[model samples]
Target: MSLALNIHSQRFQLIATAVAASLVTAGALAAYNSVSKRERRRNLSEEVLRSVSNEASVHTLPDYSVYKEDASNVRYDEELIREQLARNYAFFGEEGMAKIRGGSVVVVGCGGVGSWAAVMLVRSGISKIRLVDFDQVTLSSLNRHASATLNDVGTPKVKCLERNLKQIAKWIDVDCRAEIWRKEEGGDLLEGVDWVIDAIDNISTKVDLLKYCHDHNLKVFSSMGASAKSDPTRIQISDISHTIYDPLARSVRRRLRLLGVTSGIPVVYSTEVPGDVKLLPLPEEEFQKGPVKELGFFDDFRVRILPVIGPLPSIFGLNIATYILCELAGKPILNPLPIKNRKKLYERLLRDLLHRESKLTGETINKLPIDEDDVGMIFEDVYLGRSVIPPHLVPSRPALTRWILTQPLTPENCVVMEYADAEKHVKECSNPTIHPRDIWGEDVNALVERRSEEVARQRAPA
Candidate 1:
């Protein structure tokens, strides 16, 4: 009995020893992994800094140690603005709205996107904002810059935008910096700012600014080449790594990657083919008065002389502001994961916009033979969900059903079937009558399912 007891005691000790050894190994591994992750992040940051060293060397940023507490004294009418922001209440709730109202942003480069984003942030209850730009409004900027008009021609863009931003929300604080934020100059601009909105057009300047933001761990968002795009349907918000087609995004991404940064910056860009684009030189009379020409570099810069569309830049600006606010509010942002997978980014945004009515008119999606190439001719976004009409098939509207359809339609190719669509078909018939629903046949279900599967596959994250 004593021998048996001794064996049992020895086995118990062995088990405890094994457990202690396993715990020691696990603890060491955990510590090693944590240190490794921090090291990787530090290395990535250093690499990107090296990539932009030349540009960053142009100016030393001013010390930020002195002004961090300056924001504490800035006055805000929180109660009044909260009442005005009642619509946002549904999105962010009272506590969240307060966070937004107390937020601050600095928009660099007060051009088309910058000007518009500034106004959006103001109206969304951002109390403090700083606008920076060296360029003044000119004859040509009137075509694209939303805040500038003929009366404001030759005036600094930041002041003009600041004026417009304050006019909407009188309690909001607007600080205007009209000088160029040179790569070598002071970063006093970023002091106490919660977000830095990068609306810069120059690649070198953008690289420098991005490097600073990454190094400081500042939350920054950028706008990429808004010029020469015509498709209003293709504007998308995505990370720097996932962008395609836009030359500005490509340049920024390539340069940042060389610096050791492969992701973490979100950008607003367009993927649509710039249709019928031709780069025209500044008309001689306009060149003398143009804001773009005021920059010394424009004497030889051809890229800056590209076509400027009316609303495309504004769309990018609006999207950037919306993404920032929505993310802050914890609303579902159309995830950029789709863009990363080479799937339809803008089309998904279009889909979200057109989701007003649930059921679409059968005529909107006329069952027909279609080639993928014919997508442009057959599909378009309407007040209801986007339609896929076949030119060959005529439409027929049924009488009011007095009920809303609860069945969800295919999200990819959906349009609305309104209960009151009969009112639109009054010209076709003297009497209101319901027709027999046409059968789509067996292939219809299979086709929809197949397309959905394909979309699902592409949409899944890598």
Candidate 2:
């Protein structure tokens, strides 16, 4: 019994020793791995943080010392500036903001897109912006235009925009020119600008500016007609050279081609003419009648007379601002992604699948032949969205429908249906029919009275 007990005791002791040894080995290995992993993690984190911080700070605070010493360089209202910065960071990653600050931008028009571009550029901490416009504030410009007000009537656009920009950033260096952008002066004006944004409405001026930019190797973006449309989805930023079969873009391309220009110019444009084209000039006689007194001179002049409500210039202005932000920040969030990926098999497969589905669903649309008898009437009514021939007029037979589709009708409504095309149509029709100019006209007498009061107040005070 003693011998058996001694053997059992010896076995238990050996077991205990083995467990301690195993535990000691495990602990040593764990300690070595923990130390190595911690060192590696620290090195990696420091490298990444250094790269991002160094790039981002160039556009951000730069240095804490610089921020503290100069009250005028940064907005005194730090909270507001910080809020705006945070929003900007959300839209453009930190690296992008750095690029924006490092670059210089010039805006060629102060109306609609130009105004918003100016505001956005300043808000993004783009230290320098040059604004060029030769127009004056008018009663009709109160809505979509930024610096337009009852008091700003007849005031130069540059001065008005300057005042508003001052409120946004005290340190911003805004170069305002109260002169039209002349092609002759293009080289000098665009010398140091990293990018030029074309918001000018005049076709000749647009062509000249584009050619100048192309020749100078300066990056430029031009806005297509934004006055008559509202669908924001159809609007995109792309190289103008590749845009094909679009009417507005076609016109621009033709104009550029006439100047012996080739493709590859960047542009921001919509694919369709807006449905709310009623504001456009009805006829030469009607247009010659001058501004409607009720509508005011500026309002009558700017609104193209048409039937459907269309895109207000304000919406386009906002879109223009967004594109500028994307370009400056080196981001590419603009839709239609510009046709740079046509080679991908997945994309082709998806397109083929869509085509097959359309065929199966009877969604393979066929163009109806236009009948000469109904061309004018149908064409006019098409803009109004009420079919000239009522749906009830068609016979309730598949054969009749097929015959209608096959028949040569002069007033044929050829419908091409696609998500992108429909979106473009809607964007072109985004006009907020509300007129802010009417309010300005109503305040004219009050404005005169206020001026008189101001004169009296100044005399009394002095």
Candidate 3:
């Protein structure tokens, strides 16, 4: 009878333990749910309040209605979006199409390429886009710009693009920053963006943006110079390290390399070699009073006016939109050229770039006796911020090869020369903090100034 009682008591304890475990679990789960709900409420309230506040701030801007997004309630028109993207449904199916709708994109420069890209992204099911451009619509932009019209004359490009985008898809949200995209604003503009489209024509700003994106781990695609090209079929995407034919791309590449960006910046470019097309002259005001230069913008590149056709920018914009969608959908980019032949292509590019520089300096980069292809690789590595020793630097070079020459002897920099051989110079030099230029001399700046003066002499018959 005592043994029977022991068994019954054990069963009772087991049941009580299970009951206690269940009660504790229930209490913890309830607490978690309550906390989660409260946090969600706070986040939603902040979003709605921020949206409302922005609306109020920009109420005076024209076509302000297009930027409105009431985050209080997210009413997904799933049926409409899916039906509209049914053809895409054949591609991404339901899940992929949904990703496109949910993704966000930022297009800097709402001009010919960006305007078209913005509209295409919206139509392709991307519900949100941010447009940046400071320029107001002028008559000159009407030829190629997708969003510009006589009605949009004197209006900011972002505003015009936003307005036009809304006409295409009323449910989409367009954020307009009627200001030029500068490096300082990168954080806010790129925040939460899946892709950044570098439609900016200004080389300096474009390169700066590329560097910014590169550092911040943001994905960006640059549109190369579309000027004077008439063939839409020539539009192709080439990595920056492999770019050729486009002078703008090469210049930007060289500058980018100096700034420690050696990786391939994918650009929408054309392989159709440019002919000797005489550039159209710009007004004196364009050169003397250019907005970019006047504002003391980028140190390396300047803005320029270029001729563009209606078809080319449109095609370029279409290509950018396509790439962004494909990238977001986890698919391979269509027509993207690989860097497999980078050695061959880079040599040709380097030859061209060197020759271009020679026109100003009257001499080639003669330090390295290495093979041309090897030189190309060295530059490629150098630009990527890699620490590979530049074999071109010698003791004779002035400017210490700009740090490529020596270990920068002494903290004062009087002696930047590396130990020439078995290490005797270290004991010989007295003042280590002497100016490096005094030890090494150069006259290359004359050529640089010559190039600048030539550009400033805009021979336009105003």
Candidate 4:
């Protein structure tokens, strides 16, 4: 019995020794891996520093001391940047990637839309960028901002973007400007850039920036309203003149036209009509305290905030980045499918309108004052593919009808209505005793009058 016990005790001792040896081996391996990782990181840092030093003699590099622990030894890791951008290289090819890498972009307004755009542009092989913003990162910005954290609140938005962007691509050159973009100083801010992205939310500032880019003949892409928009599918890229349903676009288009810019600029806009979403109201006490203009950061800047669904602005930014990248790579989006390739629809509408006008006037009319393009603008832009009547319902059989029979069928006088509504309007207008305002209410008349003014403004000489 004593001999059996001794053998069992020896077996237990053997098992314990094996377990201890296994634990020791695991700990040693873990220590080795940790040391190796640190060594690898240190080596990479040194390599990047050396590469940057070599490139520094060719051209001046931006101050990157803040990003590195060893501020004296700043670096550019070409191999790392290349590895990071391998996918883009694959897609754009060597020649295209060369252009993309060489291109520089300036983004105004480092908010939700601008932040995401700047981030992606840097990630997509754009090595140089200028971030300009007068505002600071707010706690509220975390919802849609690409990189802002709780710690970034109250800091200049441009600085925030610059820091985060440098982390993305150590080789990237980011010019951070924490100042408002005004016409007087825009030249200094915008000079020496390949492309300018207008993401300013304030209307006046946006218009000024666009006009500056237009006058200077800079290749500029603008982002229209993303606030109060939720449907990502409805977002589209089109010429500024073709944007519709977005009040911000309409205002910008009108202002641009008055400034002698009918349409050469490209804009990203949403067709989703803001149903009932309104700007957040200010507190009653605040309104009573003083003039509302005093409440704004700057005069004429918006005091009330627009409600934003987080994802919409990011989508807008993505679209902007994608477009600019393609253009820089010499592969422009010849035709964005979202901007409906429906020339046939426009032509059919024009034909139907001409026939209807002839029938109503009892004369064989060859043409009207408007063409298919004008009809399209009236149908899609002005009327938003809905009847101009009460409730503005989308009709099953929509037709373009002359609003006032006494007046000629000009773009301003045209309106979209159901076939039945058009027939009713024609019948009512046939009687000289009845005025069109009497048939459609004063509210409708007011709306039509506003639309007419808008159309007239658009048609005015640039």
Candidate 5:
């Protein structure tokens, strides 16, 4: 009787436990559902709010097929098109397509880098653009520019690009400015525009435009000197402030620093300084003294005569385009505008790796050459409220390479018994990496000068 009573009590206990577990699970599921529903509602409300806030009304949609036949007429490689579209769908979604069709971009220059950048923008479905340039197409410019052709030799670059962009998107609203951008003219080139692309060649002119764009709170992406460089892999999307060694970047940073601005404006620039010899038209006396004082801005864009017109600029230009697409779609590729390097973490890892390797190998610790300026400055900036590394002077190879080698390696490139690759090395040595694309500013005046040039593009209202 006692055994039967025990068994019955045990069965009752099991039943009660199972019932309790089921009730708890059901409660959790209910809570989860409520939270999920709330989140969904919030997201929908936000999307509706955004749609309503946009100047281009959510009601008036854009036509995409206006230039489809024209693009088809260009006979682009079908396979390549598929590959690019598939890879970049994140930047060219249906909504992005609508934005491209409805939106407008003011291209500041129609030269080498700008020409291709404009072309990529149009091909990516941007229907409306204002092409601005003060110069006519030159034979020399045609060598590296995409908007120039034999028939376009004497025509203004803005006009030629406009014609091409129109051919790609027939209904694209195009404005041609056959003059430079200035601050005093006080036109609406930036007004009612979605974004700006800086492809201008002159340093002073580019600086003025950047100031205007910054002041107006317009999104702008500027290309630094792309000439006289051979390594396509080195070209990257970095902040004008973070780019290292290159003359154009240095000049840009100097200008920004002079203006007392912290940071704004995304840029595509290179760390590899141009190493080519140029014919400088300096004062006759100055020319004879030494190889004409290397014209900093001019030297930055000078390229060596190559055996073939290589894919370096084209590839870099394409990368710039990809970043731009990311900006336009509101889905950025690298954020905080231009990517900032994590020098501190890199240093820490190198030191730690070196110390560990020395202990294992029973050798004296070798001190890695640390830049007194960089080490102290980087640490203080990150720790205290000191300014971050100027974008133009961001550490690249040689300096970076020196810093890395300070860590003791086991003869091989291994990081002291670790299987860390280059990417892993960077990851291990970085602080929280923020998307570099969101570094837009409310005050455009800080970065760009308005109406400095007499001629600016003007677009008719839709």
Candidate 6:
């Protein structure tokens, strides 16, 4: 009987324990669902509020219907516009501000780099901008894009820029072109723009656009290879011929040179040698499928994506914007210092030239008439960093030597040559009887004279 009673007690206790555990789990689940519902409601409420705010902002923009034909002519409240741009006006002053406000810019490739450039340009008082891109905003773009949000996904990038930029400066004209810029139709797209910003990533397209701009005498600024670059200090603005330590610049320079374009294009590039980062590899199955180039959206576009840290492209954009703004304000950066210690190279070249001259003249000369800066001008600006001889190859061991030994060392007489070529010229043409034309041909002499005269005119008082 007692055993039966104990068995009943154990059974009752087990039932109670099971019922208590079930109640706890059910209560916990109910609480969790309550919290989850609250979170969902809160998120939905915030999203709705944000949407309403965006709509309100759009509606509040100054009415531009009167100047529909030319939105740039539409006048806004003078006090509001000035207040919006007061900080910029303070720095650039009235005339500079006027120039900036009147200037128009066209930004191609509205991606991480171009988008930021467009935003800053608008914010800085640029009255007109044209955005050209044939891409859609993806989920991944939000990290680096200047104004894209989750809501902007699947929208055209140029349209996204237009919508946001219009909100930033109600009076500004934002022309959105949602088509690719082909060489055949690019002229129409770029027509009447004060500046063109080339933030294109595709190598062939970039080269084509730059060449087109060069051919048409368009004022253009290009951004080079911001992917996989992190160091902001390494960024620089220089003519394309002088760009160094950048693979994109090197390839573009070579192609442009082949097309008879050696220089005169300004570019923003990173001097930092790329690290171990590489283009993302294609899957093995992709190789099994066929040629990788065939898989690209278009021929010559990169099939593989580059690994980009979000901040690098933004920095590049800022640099481009800063450069363009200064230029539009008529305060161009005439002498951007190359970060790779080019001054040391110039100094060394000067020393080598002095030594070579001492050997030829049989005098221990401590100095020449020209200084290191002159040497740099002669080597870079005058000769375009190549030998003034047949083939005009970029010298492996570049040396600046006197073109005419009889003439004293001066900007007009100095020339760039290979170290060995300089030595050979010293040995063979050092004689008072020999003329440079006899050895280097009359064409070289004429080229040198033309370059010298150009330099002379440049050095003359304005």
TM-score of every prediction relative to native? 0.54, 0.52, 0.58, 0.69, 0.52, 0.58
In candidate 5, what are the lDDT values of residues 328-361, reduced to their tens digit? 7767775543334444544664565555445444
Writing each residue's lDDT as its tens digit, candidate 1 over 1-462 gives 454435358787898889999999999999999999999999999988886786855667655443333433534345555666778877788777777877888999888888889888888878899998998898888877968988899899988887777666767788889987765664888888888999988766788888888878988999987777788777888888777655456557757877787788889988764444445666666645434422121232344466778798899889878877876665637666434423353343333323322233334433322221112211221111221122212223211211112333333333222223323322232223421122223453344445445333322221
lDDT of 3 by residue, 263-373 (tens): 657888875544435544555656555443311112222344544677898888998898889888777575675436546644553454344334434576643232332
Best by TM-score: 4
Worst 10 residues of 5 by lDDT: 453-462
Report how far residue 349 has shifted in candidate 6, in Å.
Answer: 10
Q: Please, what are the lDDT tens digits per residue for candidate 6 over residues 19-43?
A: 9999999999999999999999999
All candidates: CA RMSD (Å): 25.0, 18.9, 22.4, 12.0, 22.3, 15.9
Q: Which stretches of candidate 1 lie over 4 Å from their true place?
A: 1-79, 282-304, 330-334, 340-462
Look at candidate 4 and give me any clashing residue pairs.
none
Least well predicted 10-residue stretch by lDDT in candidate 3:
408-417
Better of 1 and 2 by TM-score: 1
Kindly provide the TM-score of model 1 when superposed on the true structure, using C-alpha atoms: 0.54
Best by lDDT: 4
Judge candidate 3 against the unseen true structure and give its global Cα lDDT, from 0 to 1. Answer: 0.63
Ranked candidates (lDDT, high to low): 4, 6, 3, 1, 2, 5
Tens-digit lDDT track of model 4 for 1-462: 455445358787898889999999999999999999999999999988887788765577665464564323556567756777899988999999999999999999889999999999999999899999988988889899999999999999999888888878778888999998999978998999999999987677788999999999999999998877789999999998777566677667877887999889988999886555445556677657445442111222243366788899999999999999999998899987655645566788888898998898789999787776577668876788899998899988889888888877788998999889988999888887777789998888889999898677655432
lDDT of 2: 0.57
Please give the range of 10 consecutive residues that has the lowest summed lDDT in model 6. 294-303
Candidate 6 ranges beyond 4 A from true positions: 1-75, 283-304, 340-462
* TM-score winner, 3 or 4: 4
